[model samples]
Target chain A: MGKRPDRRESFVVRLYVADREATAVRAIANLEALCREFLPSGCELEIIDILREPQRGLDDSIMVTPTLIKLAPPPVRRIFGDLSNRGRLLDALGLTGLELSPPRP
Target chain B: MARKNQKEREPRLAKAQTGIDGVDEITGGGLPRGRTTLLAGPAGSGKTVLALQTLVNGARRFDEPGIFVAFEEGFQQVAANAASFGWEIPSLVQKRGRRSPRLAFVDGRLSPGAVQAGTFDLSGLLAAVEFRAKEIGAKRIVFDGIDVLLVMLNDPRVERGEMCRIHDLLERAGVAGVVTMSTAGLEPPGSFMLSLSDCIIQLTHRLAERASIRGFRVVKYRGSAFIANEFPFAIASQGIEVADFGTRPKYRVFTERVSSGIPRLDHMLAGGYFRGSTVLVTGMPGTAKTTLAGAFVAAACARGERALYISLDEQPAEILRNLASVSIRLERYVRSRLLEIYADHPQETSPEEQFVRMRQRIRAHRPSTLVIDPISAAIRMGGQSTVLGVAERLLAMAKSEGITTLWTSLYQGSEEAMEATPLHVSTVADTWIHLSYRAGRGERNRSLTVIKSRGTGHSHQVRELILDDRGVDLADVYTVGGEALMGTARWEGERAEVATQRDVEAEEARKRRELEILAAEIRAQTEGLERRRESLAAEMRLLDQSITLRERNESRRQQEVRARRGGEPASRAGRRKGRSAPTED
Candidate 1:
């Protein structure tokens, strides 16, 4: 196996969304906010527009738009539905114990 | 008002031929073009295969490019599964030409990370389909197991909305598409896809009569006509073939005749069965039904025409042996490839499967004649309606191909059953020959009766069937006092007639001998009288001689003695008188 890359560099995240759609826009903004706030060490993020690159979406087995996938850092995690609930999104991403904002009441 | 009239005008929907053998026949021309058709069925009901085959056949046959989007199975799996039927999917998809049809497959099967952190619609699926269709200029599309993807969305509202969106997208793209949905408990009671699609075809599989039968029906078709009855379909080695009664082939009347292999039977049928006609030979057990069918097969093969015999009750070897006893030699024809006998147990497969296999064999063999030995066994495999459907399709196929067919039906001896006709096969059959046992005259005799023969004159008399080493033989019906006599009874009648004729001749000969004896007696009596008269005449002659001598003496005496003459003359006179009397006598 190849040498383990840097922690933040190894983590590759991709978010699939339809181009210019309302939920897709919100999902991208929310994902960006989550990455910036949680993964302060920086994480590789790629946004795929299903409308523009449908083949990529099909290849990735994306049934719905605005689907998030953590490709690297082992034990890949997935979250669905625009990532609106920050706590649930973090929990689904396996980042619950990581340094981040406290849960809202 | 003119603009409103133009808006209100109904646009005629274009039809897209599915290119499947019987599907397009059931769906009018095909599903309404540039619209969505919902194909819902349980797993293993061939929903995926049906959709994929439409695309495959469209690409191969009609020069219509198509896109196949699979949500459950992978593209490779689909291609490999189709490869068994000799449908090369991967190559077909890869092949491209300037104007030739093309095939594109989009695998929409979800992985573990497929759905994550996103509020998504069916845009991804729609985009993939549209992009591929556009890339290949496809005019047909298929979404296989799309309901699985919808179910994964975990919201009925999203599923309904997604179904509507997909319908609109397919219609706007102007590509005729078929969408397959899985209905194994994941489907809600009231289906969203069924309501949104322009046409909905439901496929169902059930176990009946100890076998699994698959069926499909067009639940709804908007702005078009379709077959509503649930038609039986089979997933054969090639693909799904539905037995659709709506598109039943109309066959022209064939005037030619085919022999039934029995000369007397041919005579009974007025020169055999009409070409392309269905002949039902019904009888009780031990009536040689199969043997009669064997004769038909033998005749077909003898005429240098191919024959197919489906032996459901007996194995091919057993049938050959049994037929051989009756001098119907099918072994040589089988060896010569002029005849093919397919032997299968009725309980081994469903009636639908048997029908499909039979059709496949027919297509492969293209026989001029087909025979089903004891079709009663096949009828027993399913409900009356199901079996009738199978039988009807078989008969239709045979008729359409102008193949003479003979089906043997076993009928128990009952007035109602025999009169009513078992399974209504009598109606479908062009000619029906009923055979039964005559248990009279202290022996069992087989009788063959032509119950009904259409389009030609047939003998109504029941012929006594005599089966020997020379095959089936029909004897002239013998009736005494309006009662048909057979076996010992007929022989007894003939014997009695012969005896009566002999008795009359003997009595006449005795009377003639008595008359000859009486004539001999009368002649003997007459001969005796004649003999007496002759004797008397002889005596008289002798007497006359004597009298003449006496008279002479008397005269001499008279001369001699004059004095004594008186006494002598008197004696002489007496003597003369006596002599004269003798002479006159």
Candidate 2:
């Protein structure tokens, strides 16, 4: 057994996409923009292609695409669908203070 | 010396590698640090490519060293195939030095031969893999086509027995490895290797219509969870790529409704459908379900959004021509790549394979809307569980991808309903359209009604449908005295009788009016005749009186003139007699 070290805490905003192509490309672009605007510099933004690496898609029990999983905060949260709604997305991701206004209908 | 010291400072766990890009994000990092995964497939199913790609991906994408153990294909062939895909494996091996290169290939056949013609049992292969692993300090390893090793052994039981031994050897060596198995005749029963591996990925290829469809399903991935559906995959010059199997991204529900192309249907669905919502169209045989679905595809294509139509029942050419007869030109859209038609019989392929193929095509095309004409046939291709599971996964996948999906179902009787209903489909669907033929008065009338539509108000009344060369049209409901006819046949006989009775009454009334006018003319003429007769009688009387008076006068004269010879005759006589008698008078 290896010696135990000090416990380290990290914040990661993971986006589980169906594949690495058109929709995912656009989603990655949007998420990158969002992260640039809202997330702290030290926080990590991880994008996982569920189709390329299906085990990951399964580990999270993700049945849908473009699902964003916020792992940093306790009680892991998930927001499904397109991440176009900035306010709801920010709220779901626990970035409420940095939330943007709701998009027009 | 400084670089070596820096490398020594790096953590050991950091040395572990994942073969696929963007994958480390989900496994909490990657596949367990030092575990074996078996990549299994039948002949020519791209098993070798997958293994080689994994090795190369690990080397280039993750900075992890890897080793390829070739048992079937020669080193040159493997290198050449990889080179065609733009992978310069030989150069990478040369650049990193034979000692610390990122990749190396070990010939398994030579390993046994090297051991005094009595090679070190399973230890030889393990040692070579580990030797190469340590030489380049490789973190990931792949055994390209392990079936050669299995075939080298004469005893079948011994071959099966060696699986655990090989697995243990790899585990002890701390090298994460993937073994390729040629499924050939070695299916579940024959391949005892399946039970020994930590992860099992089965690749399949089905030759259909001169087009080959390739797919893979993870039968088991030990500790890690994976999307259970057999995801569709493709092998091109670049490598294997899986189709997107994620949930549709949630978009704000657009309030606008797009026409279904069939005007009567549009009215039935309450003026069209909301964008980004799924609609289910179901019906019996010859109910124009395909026509309705085709119209939807045409409408979507006309709107300039790429539309995909997957037909599990008919041929693409026939369906296209069928639509063209109704004035829907799909060929133009097809030429523009805005419309794609995929047609195949369900019996010709497995449902899982079919789903994968569909996903691959969808991913490639990225159509705005997808239509599965008669999803029932697609589901029936697989067993009940497989069909349900595939549908569940597919619906979830489509919804997540933000692609509006329309699935058609055949309304079979209760006995077969369980398999055909796609019961779970309703849960994911935003709208449901039920089409049925109402039989009445010896004629069958087609009707469309919305059984349910979420987030939008829709009509509940069953609307009559008209499909012709001019396209579908909604006619004013046939209503008599405020009651709409249930069906054309049901109302025909009674309506005809009522119309005939009305015509008879009109004819009788017209004849009576003519008789009245004739009777009035007859009465007027009779009155005039009576008056004339009276006038004639009066005239005659006057003449008679005059005659009588004249006669009297003649008689008086005659008395005087023999007297006056009775007036006239008597007057003539009287004149003569009076002339004779006048002298005497």
Candidate 3:
């Protein structure tokens, strides 16, 4: 169930990959940067490498590698391939007009 | 994790036993163990089924756990499909009570809209297989339609690399693997992947003259000898059964005799047909072939032995009705389970498929006798080679099981060759009865001829085939002027012989009566002659007596004359002469 977080403005995203393949590494890094820039202190990210945990990928019906799904802020959206398209990811996450928050230690 | 180095412990020469009907024999045992075996075939050729069945059979028979990775179908769909063959996939895959699961299925089907462009691999599928194999301690794994997953990559390099990785993964896991690949047309799957596998099997389906034939070949087997021919197979209700045409079955020669349902016919066949021998009843159309077969089956059932009658032209009810016309009631036997009638249209399936079904039926019913009425219809399903192949196998199967089999074949041509039968089964059959029609005497008459009866004396003369409500009866060969007679001609010939015999007998009786009358007339004439003689004798005696009296009187006169004057003697002599003359008259 992709439900909205309770009592707080939260960001939840899941990134699927196959071990440390280049596209998977790039997708993880790009997704982390986007979460750090957009959701600041309240962002939660769960990265799943199919190689390590294929059952979870099967449960999520993940067919492609380096797939990202935004599971919060009301509606859920998915992006396939490398997560290098920052604008499309932002638009998919419904953060079109959101400002970048300062990085937290 | 106490995981051992499975690669180091693998047996290089060991093979995984495929519990299919004939696959193990074809592969000289089974596929190379703990290695990848590629199963390639066209769609609907039973590639997925063969792979899945191998896994199921392995788990069930060999006590080996298995994992199934479906790349084209979901786990639920696969389970549902397997259910048709009576394989309880759910129970095999899930744990209930304290019993551990022997099988696991992973659905790897891709969604319609799901697409990837960046780096990707089948590592996820590998991980799923490995995890499940570890959980259940599986020794066998099946990848149903791995080509589907391979096609998804769209990159040849990655696909190749992933294929190698999967091979390596299976090798390291020390589990036997069957990777099924679906192909189109005749060209096989990727040669690289094929070369990398330990063994390769190819399955194909082709339709020939209204028959759909499924065949498989063991293309290559590493470190083992195998049968490399393309063997036809069928997907029966009990899964797949491969037909090995090359195997020469061993048969026991049974000495017991069985009645042919016709006492006279059995007399023609010595005592009766040999118990484990094959009887072929060949004839033209409307020659009572089915009726003859029915008679044999009925007789078998009467003997209290199970009988199976497979009719390709008529349904079971129709066969029963037709059999009843000949006073052969099979319903009682059927109801009592001593007789089983399996009737289906010859056009319903290929000859091979029909044979497979028959094999299954035989296994289930364990019939002591089998009758295939009009086997020509079944032989017509395929070409000459196929027909011959099926015939050989069928006869061998029946003989090996000591089943007395009867088959009727129809010859449609005008010329009659008693020695040559359809499907060329005459060579292997123990007895052959040929029925034909003679277009003479203004009516077509059926004649039965025993072409060949091995190890027994048979009647050489063609007898008249009479089929009636009383059952099949072969009339004694009625011949006239060196030609065997039939129908009205036969009846006429028989009548003429009887009439001739009656004429000879009547003529002899009349001659005897005339001789008796002639002897009586001769006797009467003899008696009349004797009576005449007696009367004549009486007359003669009377005359003599008269003469004697005259003489005496004459003498007395003479004496009186002498006294008077000697003149009476002359008068006496004259009286004597007169008496004599009267007596003579």
Candidate 4:
């Protein structure tokens, strides 16, 4: 009713991990689930292994591992942690305003 | 030695490829031909890998057959590792058949007696290499894990002597060779080998918080000029690679300007940087070097040009958020595949590996612009000459690929106090932008100046800069009070003092004027009061005279009545006689 057009949008979320070891692997798994649950239908996700592709990490200005970068809606957002915390991850992705259904009884 | 006839022309010297992707540019093509190059490093520093990659690259890419001698790992292990990196070494060996280069794997437990008492079995190693080289017409050779040979000998003197012998033999064979030595804790015992060899490259592995960094320096390269600094490198699945990091002019056919994403900064650079040019930015710590690099990447991305940012110091998340404060949003670009960010420390890997990784990434991304923020960290990780060699190679690669490369150098201490930049980056840079902080008139100020730009016209004067929520802005060049304050500290102090002094002087002058006006008003009022008093005195005197005249007339009238009534006739007659005389007078 606000007269604003409901335009479909798409974006990419990049994750940079220090080493492709267990910690990075687990973080990636959690991030994938969080993205599926919280992100819109058109959104995409990517993970960059800094150790394997160190040059890509440098080019992206990624120094630390397990860093999540949100690229959408013009202004970009980034979170530096595992994406297991649902509330914090959503806030970091700038998806705080999206509504979710209540838990089933 | 063969003597040339005076009239006859001298033959051109054959060049040796450094095996680094773009290193040919710095050394005028490559290392000196038919000379030994000592490559030294600590344990797990990828020295062997670097030497192997150079040999393999020469063999496969340049069609130059090479010989590799391994003192530690077996031939199969080395081949397996190479395979994981997408290289088919076994096939290459099979293709050459009997002419292929030989891989000599020596068991570490081999006794000293087998080495011939005090003499190392140089003849045996030489025979194997010579046999392979003759079969394959090989021109290059590499010694993998020389430290094992030295350790097995158990005598520094013996090691030095054997290295000298090997150096002489390699020179005599007319074969270009690279010897990899383990530096671990011992001071490079290969100094003897390095001194005898035509070139010496020192590799270092540094561990920094959660990241591994590798660096390399060229100690000496005879018969050719090389960049002189430690350069960042890495080890990947394929092999060792080096980041061609240096301060060199980037040459391109195009003469177009590229935006920096920030409007005000674009004006400061005389309308942004030229396309495919190298820009060197030198500044102190926390002067926004990373932020500026990020902004440039963002601008390139907005224009649909692929941009790559290489960070050698910080983590990706930290850098991204820091840039976000300046309104440089990298997340969007990353998602769009328009911007690529690579972050690593200098200690986790080797310079050769880092270089290979960079080359692969660049080839895949094909970015229009590339940025390395604070190249000093990478340089610090290696020796001066080695870093320079890497820089030289990087410059060539960027120029050939037509990618605009921007590098930031951290200049420690005060800008004015520093006699020279940390690295001699100005020598290789096409456009050198120097940033400094100065304290003037009790205020700190920041200024930026362009030292030089190869082909483009730029502002020579230093301009003041401001960083805020809206991004960086260049203020007018300060010219107040004959002293130019360089940062916010000095500028603010000068302004506040000038304002306070002016305000105090203005207040005192105002007070003096008010006092003078009050005095004049008081004098005017006193004069009016005196005139009114005088006028009142004169009126009183006139009234007194009128009253006195009336009284005298009334007395004369009364005296006449008394004389007519005859009551005071005698007194009036006597008084009339005296009064008549006075009246006549």
Candidate 5:
């Protein structure tokens, strides 16, 4: 897949999950690959397991699992529960309108 | 759970006691222990408060630690709300960011903005809940507003699966659980969570008579028996309390009889109603129902005992002023705190809340007598069944407190309010006094009849309730031609009776005087005749003397002219000649 870089290159994302859940793991992996591809200048990522820091999850108003937040964007955005849809993730991160090419086999 | 019996086939399921008022009784001793109870209601129907109150009661009374997982509201908000109820939740909750041994609040809310990219389970929430539950050794737990979370689960199958998992977890934990959901327009949503619930309690809050009424109905309870009727419930400052007094009756039989203020009424009731008895006075408007209640209060107060009078339609001042017209002076008693008149509009609060307030007043005042004047207003403000529930509970409360209670209802339709009272008060009331207006003789008269009085024989005849400046009393019943004559008719009949007696006495006196006069005249005439007879006798004597003298004079003159009688003989001969002429005539 080919990704077009945006003028705002730097990206910061926070991922919240609950104890290595299958959906959470999949969301984490998907987010990592997408961030590496989109944020050519590198992305700062912090992962928190809500099971351990549940109070923080509550404090931050994070109830759903596998929730990812885009921090670097001027407008904060949240995508929750298996963020495996790359196109929707891009839209949530304010990275929409990026051209997509066919995936290599 | 009920008592164990020797012949019982199976033991009932153990129950966890929710210390809320009237709740445990209605639920047959709270929700089944270690089982899930689904509370279905519309939003703002008191589902959250009910569920939370149960948790607090469980933690406070049963010494059972509990956990609350809120999905719609935050735990802090829940605690803040509970503060108004004075539940002491803040102190009992987690302290210093550590799990509280008494109770724990777990956040189960999901971000409203959170978008589901793929399928996700509620493992995180489950883990947190399980951890908190164990941390507090919770015996009870609540999943409040689980509907919000369920809606986020996005798929019915996934939601069902998650619900099953939650149910299984609670079962494994062996903690009594409560799950609240906002149903769609009062209809229970056919959800798997509902099916998994062992007990289903439906809470309803709707507008009736322009006031909100809250109630609870046990829709279903598996493997147990529960009250199926929809009983009114109120969420007051203290908490949710159901108005259910059917199971436990505090019936007390007192041998002492209390006067009904009006002595004649007491006599009609065969020495008044029993102490701690419930008396119902039913009548139409203006039949002096409140007057009777006031008389009772005055009587109780006069006995140096406290009484509570509740008027649904009148103010205390109005009642006092009106009762004063009948010489029922309650001012002094009120000043002395012997009589308390609590008046209010019946539509101001819900019937359940009214019951709670009434109970509070009874407890605070400790009155020996209680009166609810014209419960019809309350019945009209509330529905028949709703107010009936409150009325029954209120009567039970009065009975348990061992206070004489009187309730008045405005009966409509016929003069025959004697058959029964509205709201089935005839059955429960020990004395049923039906006050009716008999419109006859071009005027209305108030008559009170005792339809029934338990344990005593009451007057079968109706007595007219007479209220005058002197006081309230029952007039002496008078029947004329099989109809009771009252008011002016009675006065006229009595007046006519006295006038007839007076006329008869006058006639008798006149007849006696006339006979005496006639006898006197006859005596006078007899006296005159006697006088005349005496005169005649004298004259006859004289005549006889004259005749004898004349004969003797003649013989003497003939025999011997020489007798000296010759001179008397001449005068006697003249008198004898006159007498002879009179005798010949």
Candidate 6:
């Protein structure tokens, strides 16, 4: 949780994971797609593998893998799990509205 | 024989001592090492305090670094809450010199009001704890209030998975772990949570008789023997302490007698109280309980021994002043450092704190004699019934240290209730002296009876206590006509007895004087009669002499007449003699 931002601050998000595992890959892809769709101004995404940089996980107070942390807002927030819950995930990231296209079968 | 030998050679499960006072003893040596212990209890049941205290003890006493993952409380809040306990936790969390922090707190609380997303694993929590454990080289960790975090997860399946992850991570790190869960009633968490751990400790704090009573139970301990009964516990100033934790120490026995300060009371006890034995003095209020205790302290101090008087309800100044009125002066002993009086208000603090404070003083002073005046007044205040636990510990400690102690307790109701001492500490006392108020003749009189004195003969008589400016003394109280003669009745009885004895002596004197007068009168009468008889005998002797003279004269005359005128003279003499002859005839 680095800088406090103004009202127009871009969402600088970081995802903590243990290497590029399947769950981590899924969370990364889902978060990037959601950010590109909603954050037209700008969005910065940082990936951290806890296996290599575990201290970062402690500094961020991460309790689960594939954790998404929106750190650049005035008040930083954390979302847990593998990003499978798109509706609640969007709600947690302050990107609620605008129903996306139907999921591919 | 070979199988037995192999069994003996096999290694036993290693244990990591939590260093909590009673926890280690109950678990046979704390939780299993490199394994998890499931701690379940209701809210406000001291679960969090127990967990945090374990971590603190591990860090301070065992030199084991510990991590506390606070789920319900933040780092600063936890530290602030624990500061009142006099533990140096805040300083321990900071780096000192070249050594790593002995204890560290990690906030595992999820963002407030953040509804649970679809599904989530505890990789983030696990990773954070593991990272901190490695950084501090922690050998012990406690996820305090884990139920708060789990309830938010909202799914039993996910909760089970997360608990397993925590267990596995701690096992891999070779760290002793404690996961605390909130329970309702007697029901613990899901079976999976219970089955996954090597130990289970259940704690409960509930109200009994409008007072809180905390309980501790070790449900199961794998690969170890443990005491299975539930024990009363308390969240004292130091931490949680279980009642009846250690082997109840055998009371110290001694043959030497020490005075009870009252010489007659000593005589009633044969040779005073046995040294190193606890003595209980029970009485109603205004029965001079403190005076008896003061007398004991004064006696001990006079013998050049140290004494500690713990007055749970009275101040030292007031105690000294009151004792002075009874002529048992203790100020000199206090000034000489031979006696120390600890004044405390049991109402102001829990019995656990009271016990700890007393024990600390006893250890510091090492007094050979101790007096807890009217322990009943404060032993069971309007709070937890932990006083019995405290009483046991205090008494056991006193016995082990060979301290001769005297405790006074207040008794109400009738004679039947006299045997029931508050906290039942009388059972452990070697001697009990009960003081009662015998009301009669419109007056109340204080009397003392020796209820029991083990290993020594004691008087069964109830002696009336006389309190005045001359100090305390026991007066013999006698029963007359089925009533104990006391006060004015005793004085009247004594006076009446003296008067009866005086009257009996007066009557005896009168009878003795009359007999002496009768003997004198009989002696005078016999003397008068003897004198008269002597006089009559003298008169008869004189008459005989005269008659003999006359007869000689008459015979001479007759002889002359007969010579001169023979016949004529003889006739004349015959005539004179005739009358005499007639008379003779």
- C-alpha lDDT score of every prediction, in listed order: 0.80, 0.67, 0.80, 0.67, 0.80, 0.79
Please write out the lDDT profile of model 4 over residues B378-444, one tens digit for every residue: 6655555555555556667887788888888888776565446536467777778777765655666
Residue-wise lDDT of candidate 5 within B1-585, one digit each (tens)? 244452252345778888887778887788877789999988898888888888888888888898988888876799889998898877887464654668888777765555556667776677677777776788888999988876677688888878887888888889988999998644433367777999999988888766678878998898777889887788876888776635777567799999889888888877888999999988878989989998888888988999999888899999999999999999999999888899867777878788888888888999999999877788757777678878888998899889999999887766554454457467878888888877678988988788788888887777888888998988755566888778877776666666567877999999999999999999999999999999999999999998998898678555533443365577776676566656444
Interface RMSD of 4: 24.4
Query: What is the Å distance of residue B157 in model 5 from its true position?
Result: 2.7
On the 0 to 100 scale, the lDDT of residue B271 in model 3 is 81
TM-score of chain A of 2: 0.75
Where does the lowest 10-residue lDDT sum fall in candidate 5 chain B? B1-10
Candidate 2 residues lying further than 4 Å off, grouped into runs, are A1-105, B1-29, B34-53, B59-65, B71-103, B110-137, B144-175, B179-256, B267-271, B412-420, B441-443, B476-585
lDDT string for model 3 (B1-585, tens) is 223444434444677888998898998778776789999888899998899899999888999899998889987899999999989999898785676699988776765544343455565567777877887898988888878877777677877888898799889888888898887743533666898898999999998877888998988887677889999998888788897646788889887889999888898888889998999988888888888888889899998999999887878998899879889899999999999999857677888878888888888899999998878888657776676777678888999899999998888765455455447488888998888887776887788888888888788879887877877788875777778888877777776877678877999999999999999999999999999999999999999999999999889867754564444566765676566557545
Could you estimate the TM-score for every candidate? 0.79, 0.53, 0.77, 0.46, 0.77, 0.78
Query: Per-residue alpha-carbon lDDT of model 2 for B250-324, expressed as tens digits?
Result: 555667787888776676666787776788877777777777788888889888998989888888898888888
Show where candidate 4 strays beyond 4 Å. Answer: A1-105, B1-55, B62-73, B77-250, B282-286, B347-364, B379-402, B410-412, B424-472, B475-479, B482-585
Model 5: clashing residue pairs? none
Give the number of the best model, judged by TM-score.
1
In candidate 6, which residue ranges exceed 4 Å CA deviation?
A: A1-11, A35-43, A72-76, A91-105, B1-11, B113-118, B186-190, B348-357, B379-393, B420-426, B439-445, B476-585
TM for chain B in all models?
Answer: 0.77, 0.60, 0.79, 0.52, 0.75, 0.76
> DockQ score of candidate 6?
0.27
Give candidate 5 regions above 4 Å deviation. Answer: A1-10, A52-59, A73-76, A102-105, B1-14, B60-65, B74-104, B185-190, B205-215, B248-250, B417-424, B436-446, B487-585
| Chain A TM-score, prediction 4 | 0.76
Model 1, residue A40: distance off in Å is 2.3
State in Å the error of residue B54, model 3.
1.7
DockQ for candidate 2, C-alpha atoms: 0.02
